[model samples]
Target chain A: MTQTLDIERELCGHAAVGEAAVTVDGDRVVAFVVPAGGGLSLRELRAELGTEPDEFVVLTALPLAEDGQPDWAELSRSRKDLTRRRMPYTAPRTDTERYLAALWEDLIGVEDIGADDDFFTLGGHSLLAVRIRMRLQRDHGVTVAPEALFENSVLSEQAAVVDRTREA
Target chain B: MSQRTKWLLRDPSPEAEARLFCLPYSGVGASVFRRWPSHIGPLEVCPLQLPGRENRIGQPAYGDFPAFAADAADALADHLDRPYAVFGHCMGSILAHALVTELRSRDVRQPERLFVSSSRVPHWPPDRRYRMPAPGAVGVYHPSMTEEQLADEVSRVSRTVGGTDLHPDLLPLALRVLRSDLEMCFGYAPALAPTGCPISTIGWSDDADVPPAEMGVWQECGPVTHHVLPGDKLTFLEAPAELQEVVEKDFRG
Candidate 1:
């Protein structure tokens, strides 16, 4: 077994955790655990474990292999699909927000971005920011500076900047 | 026609209280600073238009940092009439350091401050090899990286800096510039040296390329002031308020 698997076994020893699986994903150590009591705060759980992981993923149950070990490949897919974004799905509330959200969804290739979801957190890189800038200018008549984009990277914050620019 | 105007992208105001000479990183020219406003506080932003990119596309690029610094010192000598500061990002940081060293060696007036962002100290001990951020299993650049990998890195960095990918027509030249620059960086592993100039090392909160903690090594470079601000490595392009405050504060009389 790997060192990560050992971590998984040790985490199972925690009373707050019903089940746990560990994996190394691209220089990040992610711990997928099922809370014994309906739920447990990540911070409180970390304090219980006595070590910090780069990412903490909560799951209902651990996928298992035929040999009864944790299914590594399935866990990988689950992590990719669900673990990256922590914010709940939130649709845009205002026209400016809706417009900014639309631009971000198209450029960032992610859907259902919440007001607080950071652009960089969604894998939004500089290239995408420039595309959003061009689209805003050409299609929406909104001229946004790259600095504006950098500072106001969240969906609602970006919308506010656009609204301010328009008002001015 | 003067050397000053030839080297600098624009003729900065002589009447200004001070000037900030900005240097571009590898594979690009002064145009990278096009987004920066003309003036911040008393310091005028004067980006150096190095040879081999943009308007100087026809000229051969410098193969070594010392040689580039020597030529720069000569060109910028007479222009240093007012108090000035030097700002460099990434490869430009090392170039900025080298330029300051060159100026000191020539007994020229030094910049009031040196602003280095997203760089490790120039003269790291012989063992620490610096590599480009690339994709895939190896996850870092090596001289053996394929042309495709280098091209991808160029595109990634360009995009990371808030620009789109390179057009097909520009890829060949871009790749050449990238290869040359990477070679220069990888070849550079000088002994740790202190700066005669005051230093301001800026670190970003979200920069994976060079983490903020890694920047503490810069304290050995000189009388140093360190800043940890919100944003990624490329966010410096935005001229964040905290960074501006640091620059203005450092250059303050």
Candidate 2:
């Protein structure tokens, strides 16, 4: 059995909640106890595990209890089967290709614009600016200010800002 | 024809009563009214192209309302071989009004009918609150917020309806055009005498940007005929048939 002290070791650059006590069985983390109102959902917990729990893992939070004890078996079955998919937490390619591809698809007549181009320089008025921001947030979970568009005026610069601010 | 620059003509019949010249709204080129000829029967539709757009991009953009209106009047003068009508939307409406005045000043034949769409009459006190967003003001024109952000912003600014992701390259040109248009409207002083042409105003009821009540102010132009259409932004596109009917009734008489 791995000691609670060893299991409490910081993981993924994020500190575990004060009340949450981690238990490790061999190389795998088996379970953890989180505060009642920490806003942590079972889905988030499962995501942190990198895989769904087996029958042994359990949640004791009162909010999670449907009737009696939480059903780990059914929850495990509902969890998505892991494919060779990269998680959102993973760092993306440094190359600007992906960002440019996204910009091209969202913006009409993007071929007429250059990559280092500014949004306002290309005939993006207020109406179109709103559309661009909405598309970026929806597609990439990135929040960009219209002012930032005018300031940076280039894909690479905007992409750098988003990359730096990307949520873990 | 000094090097024809992508002119789309609609001369349905050789004996059409009048040549109707159409002008586009802000941020739009002449191509928007390219299909007007098919709809407005018994009339020849000649959509006027503004400078610094499409094939005319090489030409310097007009700096003010007088310059723009003057250039348009000059461009149309040679084309006005027949009795003509004038129809314009938004910025075009203002230009059309000015063009009529310029024509009168030059003793040129006036348009028999003048149709203004979704614009307030020139003399109405301008709305002070309706400030044009600065060229690079972030999130002012486009919602910088997430969907959640947009909902919050939209709830606040009722004028903004839909959002679009604009091309970066066109941003500068678009800003220049927007700034110039705003300045033109803001600095405009309405002329006293209404144009001698018969006037009609068409507007969308649900267009928050140009509400029907505000659009009604267009009646100050002359013997005004107002037509209100139901629906939201770009409602004219939705009911082109109805719009065409109004144009036919007005122009045929």
Candidate 3:
């Protein structure tokens, strides 16, 4: 059996769990779970799996299509909820910060971005990250690694990286 | 042909000297290119729609890029009577590359050029977490996600494209299609060998995900020319005038 199926089966084998799915969100492994009855807690699920999931979400029932397969569209709704609890906001101050913030707003489709805002929290993914890296090189003639963005998702920190690279 | 089997040929031109077939990034459908003009000079814009999304929602999603390419190449056989090129953005670039190779393998005509925007060459291992299986490896890994996450992505992406919030009722179908598309992407393992056609890559200046340098690795496939376009990845959806100008000049030349 495929590893994904194996994980699902093992998850369903746990008490109080009727169905489970393991999916990746960026670098994290998120498991969507349905309980047999009442409400199942993440603590209980974690104890049963013996391994902590990066993100654990409980669903009344796994969304199923008319064909009876798991509904991925419904499952992906968890990303919305996750974004709400991300790190606090910080406003961009530097010129470089302003430029990136505008771009971020465009790419992320988020209206307002504080300097403390997390890129991933704003719906920034690898593809969008690549776009930002390339834009910096073109517009500023500065080179920075993609990892830099991941490490310094905050606007202030990211501006520091660009400022440092610009000076070098 | 069944209604379910139809491809999205935004503007079909049988007489056009060159055809440009576009593939959507993972988790998206052809509608992503809805704003793209019908023509880039003489080249016709053909946005090929994969199954399990948009109008193709009734069909089963292909398991991997190779399978998707194989089927796409076959279905597009008649259209290939003329000189054509395949364009894919992000993970869609891999699909375009695999489709070109699949066409060559079946003795079908190869594309005149392959345009890959915002993606690395197939040889490059993907993100560490969803790394591609080693060469000669049989399968790719698919990441499991919850429906809420998928809904958030769809809603987020939609807002960028001038779309309103995705209703809760639509989340199930949307996420299902996204998961299937990601499965095809994560499971894809195209042959590492080079193609006869030249390659052109477009990188967004501010993109941090797949930097222009990473896109440079595509040179290994064949002659590669990289162009830096303004804006982020989502800019491609707008099909900005600058992007159109570059593609027009490149394809026409």
Candidate with the greatest lDDT versus the true structure = 1
Q: What DockQ values do the models have?
A: 0.01, 0.01, 0.01
Candidate 1 segments exceeding 4 Å error: A1-168, B1-4, B125-129, B132-142
- Give residue B229's error in model 2 in angstroms: 1.5
Q: Give the TM-score of candidate 1.
A: 0.57
How does model 3 fare in lDDT? 0.68
Kindly report which residue stretches of model 2 are placed more than 4 angstroms away from their true locations once superposed: A1-168, B5-17, B35-39, B128-164, B237-239
Residue-level lDDT of model 3, residues A32-123, one tens digit each, is: 77677644545545666755557665554576667988766557644443344234556678899888887776555453467766564344
The CAPRI category of model 1 is incorrect
Q: Candidates' TM-scores?
A: 0.57, 0.50, 0.55
Q: Which segments of model 3 are wrong by more than 4 Å?
A: A1-168, B1-5, B128-146
Q: What order do candidates take by TM-score, descending?
A: 1, 3, 2
Chain B structural similarity (TM-score) per candidate: 0.91, 0.77, 0.87
What docking class should model 2 receive? incorrect
Per-residue lDDT value at B38 in model 2? 28
Encode model 3's per-residue lDDT on B113-209: one tens digit a residue: 8899877777655443243323322112235545555566577665656445654445565567677777666555555768678888999886645
